[model samples]
Target: MAIDWKGVFPAVTTKFGEDDQLDFPLFEKNLQFQLDAGVNGIILGGTLGESSVLSLEEKGTLVKFAVEKVAGKVPVILNIAEGATRDAIELARLAEEWGAKGLMMLPPMRYKSDHRETVEYFRATAKSTSLPIMIYNNPVDYKIEVTLEMFAELADLENIQAVKESTRDLTNVTRMRNLFGDRFKILCGVDTIAMEQLLMGADGWVAGLVCAFPAETVAIYKLTKTGRLAEALEIYRWFMPLLELDIHPKLVQYIKLAEERAGVGSEAVRAPRLTLIGEERERLISLIDGAIAKRPVLPEYHSIVV
Candidate 1:
């Protein structure tokens, strides 16, 4: 099946309550906020959603909830990454059954292994799920770098339809585009380099900032797609600092804080992940406030809360 892997898809935040439990209502509200702003799709249970911290049952609940809330209005891609391949496959199956539009899988973390193991992990996932799979290439977080050759091999699988290219290498991005071309879609995973990736021939973007700023993200993609380099570059410059927050180790905290400050979502995060505090929190807030102040106002639906 051909998938429309264009436009902005946010790794939507999983909102939590004061008790540190999943706030399904707030989570649904957050999803509605994105859809209302005209996002192409919603990505659930990804890194930004604190997928690692959620239990199997919780993950299932979250995916199911997202599917129901979206109600066929948008595509929902569930992140199915776990310490074990079996667990990941289980989640993938559940996601598909629950009506997720697609799946995003990352290499198994925790135990470092060889290229063969990485290839097997993804291959097994592709075999298990009929849903369109997007390889989430984030070597920095997973400690497993999938070589281009491995990606090419996996691209042969019919279900393996796209890749969320998080490897910050422009050369690799160019090479992937050359090798895969239109056969496998390439979506930008790094927010800071999204404009560069799209201009360089990426299909779309799986962005974290889109959780709080979908309209701007979509605008950026539309601007770049039409060859408005000057306008796109100007927006990129204003948005770059906010995107830079993802480079920090405490990215989830930074993103949630941005959402909270902007009135998009709660600042609450599950334990193992904590809310930003003291100097660090203040610094992030100050930086975002400044960005909001200096950046030009976007169009109606493109307005971000500040």
Candidate 2:
């Protein structure tokens, strides 16, 4: 599949049943919701998707399901977060075969590899398949930063294409643009700074809050790119509180709770990640409800002048 590497691509939540099983029917509905709102692509098995606990078989199932469900309307990407290099390589191969348009890869999980090993992990995985790769550079959470120097080294690999820029230093967007030119596409990984990064030269956004508020997320991206900064900022300001939920330790649960309030999803999470309860749950519900109450009446983003 060809990937444009631009626009709003949601790192969507994995829909699970109260029994802790994949909920295909609800998942299909939410996918349609995002597509209807004009998301450019779908990313499965991501951090927001709860990839850590998913079996390789389950990951493969998601890739294949999303590919078939989307039916070429938009690209479907699979997040690769294996703990071993060999496993990452295997997943990369399988992802391509399963019809993932691209791979959003993390620097091999669990252990903190140095710059050299991190480069090797991504390099070796890229070499395993023909699929395009978006290296996830979220050192704040991942512990290893794929520096500009590291990116210079990776430039030779044609398939190691874009990056999900989550270093949290908004200047990194300009730094990446200055250093790499158009060689590597930069997608803002943190929702809180998405508008600032896009203004700074990010090509797209790998958004988390988009899972619940798809239209608002896409509207922000469309409005900004089309030189409607003021319009975008108004909506983005409205979205800030909910967007911050993506940066938390319990992001999966928090976002799902938002999804639940929006009439788009469930709050059932897998074992070891029980559903939110009591005060914490009520606090988030208050926030989500409050935001939904004042949801912006958006402009016709699809018809915006470029």
lDDT leader: 2
> 233, model 2: CA deviation in Å?
1.0
RMSD in angstroms between candidate 1 and the native structure over all alpha carbons: 3.0
Q: Per-residue alpha-carbon lDDT of model 1 for 1-306, expressed as tens digits?
A: 235877778998888899888898888878888888778788888889898788878877888888888888888898877778897788788888887889888888788868898899999988998898888988877778888889877877999888898988867778987777788788899998899899888878899877776667877887787776777777788888999887788888898888887777888988877788899889999998888778666644344221
Candidate 2's displacement at residue 175, Å, is 0.8
TM-scores for every predicted model:
0.94, 0.98
Mind sharing the TM-score for model 2? 0.98
Cα-lDDT of candidate 2: 0.91
In the range 188-219, model 2's lDDT, one tens digit per residue, is 99999999999998999999999899999999
User: Deviation in angstroms for 296 in model 2?
Assistant: 0.7
Among the numbered candidates, top TM-score falls to 2
Stretches of candidate 1 off by over 4 Å are 299-306
lDDT of each: 0.83, 0.91
